[model samples]
Target: MADEKRRPRPAAQYGPTAALVARNVERLRKTRNLTIYSLSAELGKAGRPITPSAIAKIEKMQRQVNVDDLLALAVVFGVSPAALLLPLEDSPRHTAEITGAGAVPADSAWAWASNKRPLKFPPGEQRTAEMEYALASLPPNAREARQHPAGRAIEAAYEDVTRVIVRAAWSVEGDEHEFIDALDQARASLERTLAELGRLAVEHEELVRLRDGVPREGSD
Candidate 1:
């Protein structure tokens, strides 16, 4: 090994955030059951060939990560750049499904339905996972809707209502007694729409609070 490659200095030489990122990198690397040599090889495959000893120094917080190192680490871990930089608990998570479900606290009872990707999962599964992650990154109430500069929330609500209207009309066309069925469908849709609106309200309030740095009612 070259003299420069030797663990150059004590960990205290690096700032606290660098040490935190090092710990997170090590944790994520271990979660994939990768050894230091394997991780270095993976990095090399991604066009940045780092040595195992250097990786050891990184994991041990004996060396600070540069921009290139951070990007390479993100690729090796299969996560976004923010994942490497942010605290684990605050990182964006894949918690939503295709159903446009409500958000759950990341630490709550919700666990990813399929953490273990089968060795030979069909291509569809890969696409589905990617789609789900994209949805999960959005605010839950707006998962299927694109945001506009204005009236985005209204548009989402309109879509929900339109779906309900179509379903309700179909229910009544089948039979005379099916008016009750139409009413039931309408009621269900109304409930779902209300829930979405409630979510939208909360999200809007939170955004306002963040922008103004002011507290709103019942917000902690």
Candidate 2:
């Protein structure tokens, strides 16, 4: 075998990383339609005092971000603190769901019911955990398409399959067996939605890769 020397890969510049994070901060600020003044004010409200010019400097990559500043910025942006620091770009979140009875009319009654009475979920089951499971399966960047804006639409779809609307209406009159069936259906729907979300996440991997200037190796 012939001895061959391997070529060394060039290191990426820090300018890009700083510039990218700055660009992201500015993009988020602009997309949210926030003025530098407003952003500064908000940071103040979050108990961090910093000038808008400081934010601008950070965005221009002229200044570095401290832990408190980063945390303050994250609070203003409604994103995770680590997200602001990562070299990769993050996709926009899902659409916002309007909370109203028309969307989930059956459960709508409970909106006020819980206000009047103490509600207790059954043993060996949890609401937040189960819902989080469904949510966790979703893309880190949820489908922001018209059909499924907020990730809640996925839950809404599951509700449809489980006859959540009907179940809520009939639950008072129906037997435990009927309610159980409805929950079963809901679970199945959640399972299916989770699978779909997983697929989208894999597809979204390309978007993240692109940010790092990583090319698709197989494409000639």
lDDT of each: 0.62, 0.59
TM-score of each: 0.41, 0.34
Candidate 2 Cα errors over 4 Å, as ranges: 1-17, 87-220
Taking the tens digit of each residue's C-alpha lDDT, what string does model 1 give over 100-219? 234433322122322211112256696466345546555655444533322344543444554455555656667445545555655665666667778878889889888998977686
lDDT of 2 by residue, 134-186 (tens): 35343444423312423454755544554655566567886567667877877
How far off is residue 131 in model 1, in Å?
Answer: 27
RMSD value for candidate 1: 18.0
Query: Which candidate number maximizes lDDT?
Result: 1
Q: Clashes per prediction?
A: 0, 2
